[model samples]
Target chain A: MQNVTKSKWWQTMILKTIAMVLIGFIVFGPLMGTLLWSFAEKWFWPAAFPQELGLKYWKIAFTGQSPVLDSMAISITIALIVVVLATLISVPAGYALARFNLPWKRILLVLFLMPQAFPQLPVFINMTSIFYRYDLVGTVPGVIAVHLVISLVYSVWITTAAFKSIPVTLEEAARNLGASRLRVFFRITLPLATPGLIASSIFVFITSFDEFTGTFFIGAPFIQTLPTLMYTASMGYNMQYASVIAILLTIPALLFMLVLEKFLKAEYISGLGV
Target chain B: MQPRAAVKRPSIRVSDGQREAVSGLVLVLPALLVLCVLYIYPLCASIAGSFVSDEGIGLHNFAKAFTLYGTDILFTIGITIITLVLVFVVAVLTASFLRFRNWPFLNFVYRLPLFIPYLIAGHTMRVFLAPHGILNILISRVTGLSDLPGLAFSWIGLVITFVWKQFPLATLLILGAFQSVEDSYIEASLNLGGNKVRAVWEILLPICRPTVLVAMVLTFVSTIGCLTIPLLIGPSKPVMLPIDMAFRINYMGDWGVANALGVISYLIVIALSMYYLSYTVKKEDA
Candidate 1:
């Protein structure tokens, strides 16, 4: 028994060690290269690695010379705006989805779900025409409005799951005792679903913030975002500058993801189960 | 009954009866309006743009599409399929491995790819796979190879970049599904003389089947709409659909042709989504 247990423990330890190494390499390989390239004076052809390193690229990225800082701020602000608006709209809709049995609910659900799969490029192109007509393309609100389509769908899906978890009996009992519907909803349902609401809102923010194609196709040149700026720097052969912006832009997202992993128990839509 | 009689009864409906319905509508109106303006309107406009021509209610745009060398469209469809399959396969394997081992660090590693946005992934791949990038330099130093050929602007490079970008998402979804499998089933399979592979194929696979399907569908949908990977790493020959569509709008200023292609792509997306939804509903019913 001792011998078998020892072998099993040894095997488990070996496997775990291997997994850790692979994981580290997988994550840090490109990241390390990116960091090295960012600090390097020049990443030229035929050089094995950077021989010289300095803060020159970082200085450029931070200064008013590059639009990296401004674009990052715009991207985050837009994402937050979308998150707030999407959560506000989706909470009530999610309530209707979960609690009510309205006809055409299936249709509504499908409509919400379809956008996730739909190709966003064409929609952007066509919307550009409409934006051209209405003069909403160049501004931040125009981009935010377009982003809300995707953000709202995701928000509704997640928040509906959150709202569904509140038991009907609690609300019914409150109503039976002369408590108002608004009172029950605001006091009971909203509080119970707070965690889900928060999780979904963060997801909305992440999606909107990370959005590249729509920001490129519709809000490009005039309203630059971080991803678009990264694309431009890389395309313009400013590898060092691109890497700096890339690392800088990626930090907040990485931090948010880590925090989320701690609280958002990785069940696909866990809040939906009542 | 006696308790009920002792208490005063209250009215169920509020004084602002009609206003409640209006409030609900008011709450939903903005989102619905945006959806109509953005999604529904663009979709309609694209279709209208497709049909507009001097030829009088004819299929001119589609005729143009048919004649305009559909190799790009075909190439894109092929790439989408291959990327989905490869990503799904690799993801399932890695996820299964993680599940079997229950490795903590593996979870973090598997999710790291999600942090890099698609554009960054494309750019990173370009840098790493450039002619004088680490890939070629390593090859030269290790094997004394003079040239590490076909690193950039190649089909193989495009596939590699896409797989790298997409695999992490697939792995996460599959890993989450893998976690849901009970340990008892594995023990049961083992006791029945089944090895890990057999156990995974029979027990674990069936349990996580729905999740795998979801992952596959998402990856397919994502690849179909992608433009960056192909533009970055793909060869000049056999142009991909998204790039082609963009070219039509930008270079040619042919909104009609561009919108026609968009409409076609949208129709395919709708079909795929409907199929996925119907399957899900049926699965639930079953």
Candidate 2:
């Protein structure tokens, strides 16, 4: 019995080690390869590592000749616009959903969520006609408008969750103490909900930044974002340039994820259900 | 506690209620307007566009779309199903292990993919799975298989990329469900002569069914509609639905057929949405 138990312990330990190693490979293998490939000058097969490394691709990525720098700027500009517009629009709607007893409240909430329910392909394809009519196709604002359709859902849901989590009694108490509604909101409610609001904004920003299909459909030819640039490079077999672009695209998202780490658990659970 | 106060407050509350209603409408109006113009209008136009063609408003375009892109639609569905199964299995195992086991780094590793975008993930897959990629190098070195087939630009690569990008979300969702499971149930199962696997299967799985279902539906819908992974890694022939629809527009300039395909995709999403809605409503009622 002692020997059997000891063998079982060894078996479990080995299994766990293998599992951990496999998980590590799955998570980090591609990421590491991409990082190495970005800097590699001659990373041929049948060798364990890159034969030589240089900053040629990185230089190209940073130079004005390549679309990388411009794409990054465009992506950031569009994402910021999306974040600002989504926040401005969603905050009031979220506040209403949280504080008021509106008619067909559930339906309204579902309507906000409906944008995400369908595939973006259909919507963007359909919008291409209207955008063409309005002369908005291949324009940054047009892409931003399309992105708003998806980003608004998350922004509203998350911001509503943020508002819902705030205690009503605090607002009422402030009101009773002769504080104006605006003052109560700005002073009392806004400060408390700042973290969640920031988190939701980050979500909106990332969603917009990572938006590919809509941007590709609407912003092609005239507007080139990082994702669209990456797609073009990858399709054109410019692996080295694509790697650099991928890394650039990942940096902001990674930073935001770290910032979102604290608030994400609560926000995802509470906000996503509806 | 407030019968007298309630009666006394009604007169003051009447005007307050009206003011509140007005403010509520005002608050939601901007968002409603944006949704109406950006979202509702586009949706209506899409539906309308799908039904209209050269021959007038009919199902002709849809029939063409079905006959033309049927394989692509089926392929998309097949990939979604496969990805869903793989994601579900990986998510459940990883989530349960992280919950019950004392693997601290597992949680961090599982979540790392969440930070990576689909575009980057696809790039990573291509980098690692190419003919001269690191994966082939390792396989050749270890297994002595010199002529191993390249996995890049294939359905397998697409699956790998999709699973890598999406399974983190599934794990997180399932982990949330796992967090709500009572420890005592597992202990009780153990005390009743069940092993850990049996305990999970008997006690935990049933409790997590709803969350698991949600995760599956979410993964299915997202994967079926996804364009980046399949675009980057998927083969040219037997393309996914999104790519097929795109080709219809970009190459063929056939808006009618493309819109028809879009409507078909929308119907699939609507079906899933109905299921999700009913499930959430039932959960609420319960």
Candidate 3:
């Protein structure tokens, strides 16, 4: 009888190589198209690769000719504000939940985690009307509010996990040495949790930076971010401009997340886009 | 200071328990306040607004939504289901590869799209999947065949884009679970004369089933909620719910129908999650 259970070594090698090539294409193929287009000044069908490659579109983007620079600045500004605000709000709460016997603590955890369960687009749809009442629609404040809500999923959870990972005994030991509670926290706890805190802040910044549905609903037609700008550029089939913006929007996120993948918990990393 | 004086002074120094309680409350309130004001308030408003309409507070808006965009709702569900299945398949294969293999280039490439945002993902897919786009050109050149109808601006485009975009996150989650599972399990199966495929199928996958399910559910939920993918590459005749909901609001200025549709999507997520939660809880209890 022929052995059907095992493949030959060469067959396995071939299969593995094929799988890798397929995976590589599936992963990098679209991005390559975008990258090529970003440089392509004139490229038509029947030819593989760009007909002409130049920095013409890139110069337009970099020289503040298009709204790309403004949009990029605005996106960074909003992401920074949201990251700081989210960090400020999440730190104490995360520490409290991790260390204290707060009332309805379970409910609070569930509430913080609620964004994972809820579909966000609808809430944003309704938010437009609600924020409109307060003159927040199409304003930076309104957009920031939306980003803050989404940021909570990562900020609160990661912050809580960060604090929780530090042993309470360490804090208690410091406390027994005649150290004040605030002093113990500042010195003992915060230092230990810095890695997680930094990761959490980066996560918030990434979320707020890439945020589209919320920003689109609450801030479009007035506020323009890299994502919103990319959307318009793509809509017009301005492939060169869109591709340039796409590359801009992508690089920081990839770089930060590569660093982030080391410090953040697997669970928190998975929580992204949830 | 006498005890009576302390009581009369209303506690110049509060009790430890009381102090802790206040501290906990103070520390916890700001995050909760943000959640309440930004998330909870608008969510409630969406639900509440769906009810009040021209006629009265009822399912009138729901009935209207179903009548107008019922096909789009179904289309959304169909795309979600198709995307979930494809995403699940891609996630499992890629995650298993990452776990079982030590290919450095594979590792680096797999993670490239993981952090790319949705809108950017949409545009890239829009171009790459276009009729005479790069993918099509490559296929024709390789196979020596022409007349390849492309996937862009159709259901397949949406599926490919969703799977491609979601692949990294889903694989990361599944791969994380796979990593936690000890090598001994797979080694045990292999020692018993089981093949690598069998070892992975029987040992590794079963151990990581819960994470797989959660990953699937998350992908499903987000796929339904996705507006960017469909808007960028959706078919004109039957669209997804988000696009439909957007049209109702942007074009028609119909908030009632939008909220109704929103509630419907919300209910779908809640029902699935509740089932998952109950299943996990019941398993833990057992």
Give me the candidate number with maximum lDDT: 3
Misplaced by over 4 Å in model 2 are: A1-15, A265-268, B1-22, B272-286
lDDT of each: 0.76, 0.82, 0.85
The window of 10 residues in a row where model 1 chain A has the poorest summed lDDT is A265-274
**DockQ values for all predictions?**
0.44, 0.57, 0.48
Residue by residue across A1-274, what tens digits does model 3's lDDT show? 1454345766888987998788778888999999999999999886777889999999999894689889989999999999999999999998887787677877787788777656788888888998888999999999999999888978888888888787777876666566777898899999999988999998899999999999998997999989999999899989999999999999999899779868886544443322
Task: Quote the positional error of residue B43 for candidate 2 in Å.
Answer: 1.8
- The candidate that wins on DockQ is 2
Over the stretch A137-252, how does candidate 2's per-residue lDDT look in tens digits?
A: 99888999988888888888888888888877787667666777789889998888887788889989998998888888888888999899888998898888888888888988
- DockQ, candidate no. 3: 0.48
lDDT of 1 by residue, B1-286 (tens): 2336223423233346466445555655666676777788887888888887657565888788767947777777788778877997889888888888755666667787787777777777777777777677766877887667847688778887888888988898777777778999999999999999888888876787777777777788778888877776678888777787789887888888887788777776667667766875676677
DockQ: which is higher, 1 or 3? Answer: 3
Model 1 chain B: worst 10 consecutive residues (lDDT sum): B5-14
For model 3, state the Cα shift of residue B11 in Å. Answer: 26
Q: Is the docking of candidate 3 incorrect, acceptable, medium or high quality?
A: acceptable
lDDT of 1: 0.76
Q: Please report the interface RMSD of model 2 to 1 decimal.
A: 3.3
Q: Rank the candidates by TM-score, best first.
A: 2, 3, 1
